[model samples]
Target: MKSKPVLTILHRLAILAYVVFALFPLFWLLKVSVTPNDLLYSEGVRMWPSRTSFDHYAFVIAHSAFPTFFKNSLIVAGSTAVTVTILASLAGYALSRFNFKAKYWIVALMLITQMFPLVMLVAPIFKMLSPLGLTNSLTGLVIVYTAFNVPFATFLMQSFFDGIPKDLEEAAMIDGATQFVAFRQIILPLTLPGIAATLGFVFTAAWSELLFALMLISGNDSSTFPVGLLTFVSKFSVDFGQMMAAGVLALIPACLFFLLIQRYLVQGLTAGAVKG
Candidate 1:
């Protein structure tokens, strides 16, 4: 057998290697964001340019319509995350706790929705929403995103509910609390990690969604970050510096979001262990 110290070193090395692999793109993004346009190509493949400036970032912030795009994205992503979480929680809890007829078919149907390519569905979705006056609106984007995300989010929460024993809620009910009350106060707290995870997943999905945003939204006023990123691309040339700067700025909210709820995620795997 491998020695403990050798095994530990190998494990740590593997993690370090993976971290570097994953973070290298982000590092390059930030690096290029700060790199001067004049030196962008001249610097070649050097790890860092001889010097850097905030010109691209300054221009993108002060001059571009990115603010509008950022606002729309925040509203859409936040709304979608909250809406999907609430609906998914109720649906997942139902699927986990209740054994009504058609439960098997309901789950199978949900699974089937995930099997189709989103590309094939976007046109139909656009056509359906366009007549309802939902197209090009943030609310419409949220509705579309929520519809796409709820199924997976429901399955995710259902798994979390499965890990939790029914005894906790039963005990609560024995104390005169209704099922909804027990769920709200007791089960919801224990399911924090799942909720946090679902929120993050849905938020990221809505935040980065492009196909639906592209097909539905025609104006810059309602564009999300992913769509706004395309504004930097033109018929003649691409604005790499400003685009990279915008990309770097986009990472902030997601990073802060995870940091805010990271504590809840820490104990997800061990949920209900102490209670049971």
Candidate 2:
């Protein structure tokens, strides 16, 4: 009995340690952004600055094109996540519920797409999109993100659907409901965790995407926050404070996204524990 409390304490301490290790970089970025430029180097690796100010944040918001970049990122990431989730849900349900002749081949082809490095596809994708006027466009970025994310999202949703009992839908069918209706009301509601996880995964992937954004976008008008962070660098020097400030701002949407979906994720996890 005494050892149980000790184990519990050690477990919590381990988790706390991992959390600090993960968050240390972000904490340092926030610290540096608030540190005055004159003291940045002179402070010599201090945990917190002696003097703090919001001048970097002020400059980024008031004088830079960060707001436009933020807007572009929100549009692209949000659009991609929604598109991927909807398509993945339908595809996943099919994979879970149906057994067709081409099912194995379809799964193999999807897996093949994941085996190749994305860098290998950049030139071919760019070549294809350029003629369609998709290069240097937010819509192009969204399309690319959605296509890249869907296969994995489909697999994820399929696993979630597999966890659900087929009898639930079967019972609904016995009650005169079609497969689609049972899936819409019963299976889909039960897969909220999977859907939320897919949304967060796709949203984060689209939001932080740099290679595609850098390759496809040309000007500030279409730039995402990842690409926009480059503006802090110049021939003479890098604006560390402003760059960190922009990074901090970029994290806001991702944080808010998880916050919105966290309830569904928790609910989904606990749903399996209860019995009717």
Candidate 3:
């Protein structure tokens, strides 16, 4: 009994420590965003500042082009997540349910693509897109993000599908349902956690993506939040307060997105536990 209690205490402590470690940066960002610019450096590494103001947030919202960046990022990331999810679902179902001659090769190709550095492909991708007028366009960014995210999303969905019993689909088929219908009505619904996880993963990846956005988008009109953050830096100085405020704003959508999907994730886990 004593050993069990001690082990439980240690486990809880470990989780608490990890949580603090992960959230410390976000806490600091929030702190600096609230801290007055005058007291920022003067505070000398304090947890909280002497004085606080919302001026930085106000400036970022009203004065900067952050709104446009925010909108563009929303459109791009949301579109990419939805598109990847749809494609990955179909592909994952196929991979999980069927055995085809080309399946091995297809998986191999995807793994090979992941092996190459993204940097090496940037030049070729830019060259190809430039002629098509895709440079500096939000559509172009969405296309690139979807393509990049689909492979991983497919693997994620495949793993989820693998966990589900084939008997469920077989039973549905025996009841006069086609494979696609069975997949749609039976298998897909149960993979809500996997879907939510994929959405969150792709959204977060597309949301924070800077390299491609920077290389492809030149104008502020099409820039995403990651690129928009760079506007705060200048040759002479950097606006730390305003930058932190912008970062806080950037985090809001991602936080809300996960919160919305968390229920489905929990439900999926519960279902899996009960099934097991």
In model 2, where is the ten-residue run with the lowest total lDDT?
267-276
Candidate 2 C-alpha lDDT tens digits along 122-164 = 9999999999999999999999999899999999999988888
Candidate 1 accuracy as lDDT: 0.93
lDDT of 1 by residue, 34-136 (tens): 9999999996899988999999999999999998888899999999999999999999999999999999999999999999999999889988998999999
| lDDT per residue as tens, model 3, 40-132 | 888698998888899999999999999999999999999999999999988988898899999999999988888878889899999999999
Give the lowest summed-lDDT range of ten residues in model 1: 267-276
Positional deviation of residue 45's Cα in model 2 after best superposition, in angstroms = 0.8
Report how far off residue 121 is in candidate 1 (Å): 0.6
State residue 97's C-alpha deviation in candidate 3, in Å: 0.7
